[model samples]
Target: MTPLDSSWLAARPLPQPDGDIDKNSRGRVLVAGGSETVPAALRLTGEAAFRAGAGKVQLATVERAALALGLTMPEAATFPLPANDAGELGAAAGSVLAGYLDRCDTLVLGPGMGAEAAATAILSAVIGEPRKGLSLVIDAAALGACADMPNAVRAHEGRVVLTPHPGEMAQLMQRDKSRPEDDPEALACEAAERFGATVLLKGAQTWIACPNQPVLRFAGGGPGLATGGSGDVLAGIIGGLLSRGTPPRTAAAWGVWLHGEAGRRCAEQIGQLGFLGRELLPHIPRLMASQR
Candidate 1:
């Protein structure tokens, strides 16, 4: 296994945008799915994408939350998706989001989105679209759908990445949640091969497994990163990297390092624990710049 550390990152650095590059050239990330229950999910995600150097971001969520989310985060263009009476984005949201696939470089799905069926429907719709060059970073409730729709994910081939903690991993593999994962790397590799996508199995020491490649482990980021909304930030960072034209495996590896290192920095300045996930945002750009 390769250790994803500062030295490893320095040797294989991220691509730098040209000085004359425009926002469109840097790429656009469409972050879909949020709910009133987790109002900060989309904001934390969208802002982290910008911090990671995505040129633009668009937030698409249920209509009830769109205007307020837009007002709070003016940097992103917000789209009000169709919502059910219960306020969750439903299956119909798929068609609306499908229309935007052509223009999006990466789609970050299932951040704070509480409805599994809705996310699955949207994922199916998005995958069914015939667009090319768009990648995906699937997280949270969406991971369950991904497990059910392996064929849909394979349709995207190498352009997909799944970020799941142990619990989500259990759901993806249909393993008993109460049973301990004796070998996390084995489980990650199994999932990666089964889904034909890069799997970033999150933990104190993250294991990133891509089909046909050796597992890469990132052992930093500290326990502080276990805070709520932290996974959303990591998803956005990977989305931003993919939007910038980095391949899925590389993006997952680099994003894990960036997220972990930012958490480490947060621990130093704000203490090892109790640092909010939002506090990790500002550190991303500084960390990326230092890499250059």
Candidate 2:
């Protein structure tokens, strides 16, 4: 494993144009996730996607949380799904969500989604579908749910990007729990090849690998990013880039780099010790400009 250093930071690709036009031309992103306890995940992701230049962001989540998110971010569109008695999305909502899938340029899954029969069923339907125009970014809890679905991975015709932390990667690969400091790149590369999808394994030196290409490592992120909701923000950024028509590999690469850079910038302002994940969101546009 290569240690994160200046050389690794220099390897990241510079930022490119935000997109060809204004918000309408940027592309649409559909963010699906959020259980009762973690209602904030979907909102955080939608905000991050918008900050990353997505033209429009639609969120499909449990009904109760949907109202709050809609009111908070009126720019975002919300679709409330029927929830079970426990206030979590139920299996029956999958068919209802299928209609909206066709409208999005990219799909972002697993931010704050809780484990329940209903959420799993919805995820299965989304993953099992054979949509060609949309891109998919799978992260967090969704990673664990779909890790065993080899057929689902094989069947996906759209661009698929998997973002996993060390523990999540181990779960996906069925390996022992290993720290990101412990050869994460090799393990990530293996998982990417096995699933035939691009993998972004998050850690000190984030590793990005595709089925046949050499693994690319990003080293600029700071320890300030070691907080909850950080991965959710990264997933949203990946979704935003995908919606803008960037390829999975390029989007993952740039998203990871920009996320880390934004965290670093936020740390400088607020100091790393107490910086929150949401605090980093506002800095993304400035970070993008710096990269350009």
Candidate 3:
């Protein structure tokens, strides 16, 4: 595993575009998640992507949240898909998503997506199709969708990233004999190799790994990051960076640092227990400016 020293963090840079450039010149991000039950999940994810520096961000969710989501976020557009009888997205969403997948530089999947057959079908359809030059950040229920199909995203190689917490990690690697509880670093590495993508095993110390790349771990975040929507924020951060032309490894490295650092700051400001998930959004710009 790599230490991810300060020198490396300072030296390895992100894209720096001119002030007059449009959103596309900076990066385009599309977040696809949310069902009838939890519209806020997709909205929060999209907000984090924008705060993290994606110039243009679009969010796709079930029809139940379309009008509300669009009204809440004017800077980013929202598209609504047909919902199934279960009040969740289904495989039919893949048809509408095809056009979106073609347009965005990166896609963030799974937030507020319940573990249901509909979610599984929707994710499976999206995974079965091949993508070119597009990056994917899989989180939440999408991890479960592809759990049984280890090769679901393997064809995409380094273009994909899977963010899973301990429980989610167990779900994702259910068929494997190794217990993720024993060694997170090994689990991350093996999962990355298995999926042919980057894997971030989230915890107090997030372990990031990809095939042929040195493992990077960040142990900065406090218990403040244990909140519900915090992982959604993380998925957005990494997805946002990937949209802006950052490689999966570098993006994961910086994303984890930014997230952990923000959580650390949040904990300090609010006595370790009062910070809300939305509070993390404002901290992102501060961190970016300091890094710049």
Winning candidate number (TM-score) = 1
Summarize candidate 3's per-residue lDDT along 148-242 as a digit string, tens digits.
77776887767898999888888888844347768899888888888888999988788989999889877778888898789889899988899
The local distance difference test score of model 3 is 0.84
Residue-pair clashes per candidate: 0, 2, 0
> Which is superior by lDDT, 1 or 3?
1
Compute each candidate's TM-score over C-alphas: 0.97, 0.89, 0.94
RMSD in angstroms, candidate 3?
A: 1.8
C-alpha lDDT score of every prediction, in listed order: 0.88, 0.80, 0.84
Q: Candidate 1's residue-wise lDDT over 120-201, tens digit each?
A: 7888888875356889999998898887888778778778999999999999988887432678998999899888999999
TM-score of 1: 0.97
Candidate 2 lDDT, 1-292, residue by residue in tens = 3443334445654334553566656789999888777887887889889888888999988888889878888989999877787777777767777778988989998788766636457768787776888789988777876667866876774388999888888888877796455778788877887778899888877899887777888877789898988888999988988888887887888788778888888888889767888887888777666554
Q: After aligning candidate 2 to the native by TM-score, how far in Å is the CA of 179 from where it should be? A: 7.5
* lDDT for 220 (candidate 1): 90
| Candidate 1, lDDT over the whole model | 0.88
Whole-structure CA lDDT of model 2: 0.80
Q: Looking at model 1, which ten-residue stretch has the lowest summed lDDT?
A: 174-183
